[model samples]
Target: MADRTITLLIVDDHPVVRDGLRGMFASAPGFEVLAEAADGREAVALATRLRPDVVLMDLRMPGGGGVEAITELGRLGLPSKVLVLTTYDTDSDTIPAIEAGATGYLLKDAPRDELFTAVRAAAEGRTVLSPAIASRLVSRVRSPHGGSLSAREREVIRLVARGTGNREIAAELFISEATVKTHLTHIYAKLGVKDRAAAVAAAYDRGILG
Candidate 1:
């Protein structure tokens, strides 16, 4: 028996960042840098080809963004786990990436040991979030308004506000019509509204829609 090596694909727009990560991982044991990509598109292509155990993804690349890439990977049914390693921890960045099927989210400033642990956890299909991001999510979930809407629920409500039907939302989000209905149900309960119209109005009033 032997310790398994965790394969990784590092995705970042900056070449210097990529080089640094490669070097850092190269110096560590029980890890292998399979390849590197400068943007999400390249990341997806390389992941498809290499089928690495985990992908160290960056959020705001020029050619393609991490959330879109994560969504595409899910749609394509790739088994690679995406661990977002980005500088941004705002709600806008964390929520979408998590909803898009990222296995973990970690800050770029994370210590080497913490990053390694997160990667190992992600490779094992565990969810990981940085302390700041986790606190933000906890506060959002514990908000006084029944409960704050999840990222998918927010997407559904936004579509509802625009008069998009369940079928259209399902198609757009790549979910089934039944899933869309379920999200709407949860959204209504969270917003303290019973119907689509009221839910949309509540979302607007509560500043969740903007």
Candidate 2:
């Protein structure tokens, strides 16, 4: 390992979850817990101020919540790599978190070793996902239409299905926000679904990509 430690910010609404994560990282070598936040808005604020190497964010929170927070961070050009830590494992959650500039996603119940690996990968700006989660997501996209959407469109759909906003999607895909919107417009037109939620549901039914 390098001499420098990996700095982290933990964001979750539940005190126990945040405390547990903090404690977990505290015991691990080459890791440092720089700060904590209880919701998405606070996460954005704390990340802007602390500028940690990585953020472990929860997906669901009220009031400009988790995914939106990621979007906000990208809008401000913060360098923190987001690693989503949430209980939700469905395509609905995984795709959006990634779309919202998350370097990876992990379940709340993941083993300590996996979490440690994931955090390190995230810190290095790599996308990480539990094997099972990855398999499910890939299958979800691949099962439908078997390749109906273009790669970029599929990327847009995957993130859209996961509930990510255009800004987050753009950051994750390394595209401009306007371009992301354009992709969505095409996706919506092709999928014949008016909104992201519907596009996600339709993708699953049709097997367009997953």
| Top of the candidates by lDDT | 1
Could you estimate the TM-score for every candidate? 0.72, 0.70
Candidate 1: which stretches are off by over 4 Å? 144-210
lDDT of 1 at 103: 96
Give a tens-digit lDDT track for model 1, residues 162-208.
99999888677645566688788888788888999999899999999
Q: What's model 1's TM-score?
A: 0.72
List runs of model 2 lying over 4 Å from the truth.
145-210
Predicted structure 2: lDDT: 0.82
- State in Å the error of residue 167, model 2: 20
Model 2 RMSD in angstroms: 7.3
| Residue pairs with backbone overlap in model 1 | none
Residue 180's lDDT within candidate 2 is 78
Q: Determine which window of 10 residues in candidate 1 has minimal summed lDDT.
A: 170-179
